[model samples]
Target: MSFMKKHLKTLTIALGCSAGAFYLGWQSPTLMGDVFEQQQVAQPTPRFYPLERFIISVPGKEYQHYVLLELALKSSSANAKHQLAEADPLVRNSLMKMFAGKQVDELNKPKNLEQLQQEAKDLLTNVLSANKFAVKIDDVLFTRLVIQ
Candidate 1:
């Protein structure tokens, strides 16, 4: 009882300080809205540019197959639309070449399709970089994919 009384003031001060720190920390985000606003303003809005439909010929063991692919390029660049417009031909050509010679059985699997999406993204990035286009592709989304 005596010891508790002796340290009572110190303990109260420590507890009060801790609680005050917690409250301030909890409220910091709301208080820092200006910083967040600046960050949001610095980031560009994501844009999607859809390319023309692609009709690719896939070779099989005994027969020829066709893949109809309609995809869009996602980017966060301000001028993505204009850059993509200028690089459209090269983009289509690269993707067509990549899709060519793919086996039907290979593209039929879901896992393979996901891999293809990543591959397409990388291919587009390369094509844009090589062509000196100021575009950075974030993803390649397939709006329509048909294997016939």
Candidate 2:
């Protein structure tokens, strides 16, 4: 009985101290100030830029033809833009090969345009893996994609 009484007193005192500390903390402006500071911190938006939509002419067994591709460039940071400096030919080559892999029907299907876009995004992710400034591809838009 005595032990229980002693332990109860100790526990009660500990809980009271804890509650008081928490209450004091809640009543202070420091937490709100910290939150305000956090909100004020500037964060950069993802840098997204236009990619050249080009028509690729590949000589095939049947005949020479043109394949159109629409592409967009994205980067997590602005440094990616500085690193890349300008438009790149390698990026175009990678995009062309990716477009060539798709069937003519797949490219022409308007319903699958989203799928094609996501595929292009994934392709960019893969191709830009080795770049100094990592780029996140937003989408591939084909302004004109006609193979003739």
How does each model score on TM-score?
0.72, 0.60
Name the best candidate (by TM-score): 1
Per-residue lDDT for 87-140 in model 2, tens only? 366677777787766656566578988787777767666767755436555555
lDDT of 1 by residue, 18-82 (tens): 99999988888797765544454467779888999999999988989999999999999888988
lDDT of the candidates, in the order given: 0.88, 0.67
> For candidate 2, what is the lDDT?
0.67
* Model 2 ranges with Cα > 4 A deviation: 1-27, 30-43, 57-65
- Which residue window of length 10 is worst by lDDT in model 2? 32-41
TM-score of 1: 0.72
The ten-residue window of minimal lDDT in model 1 covers 33-42
Error of 2 at 75 (Å): 3.9
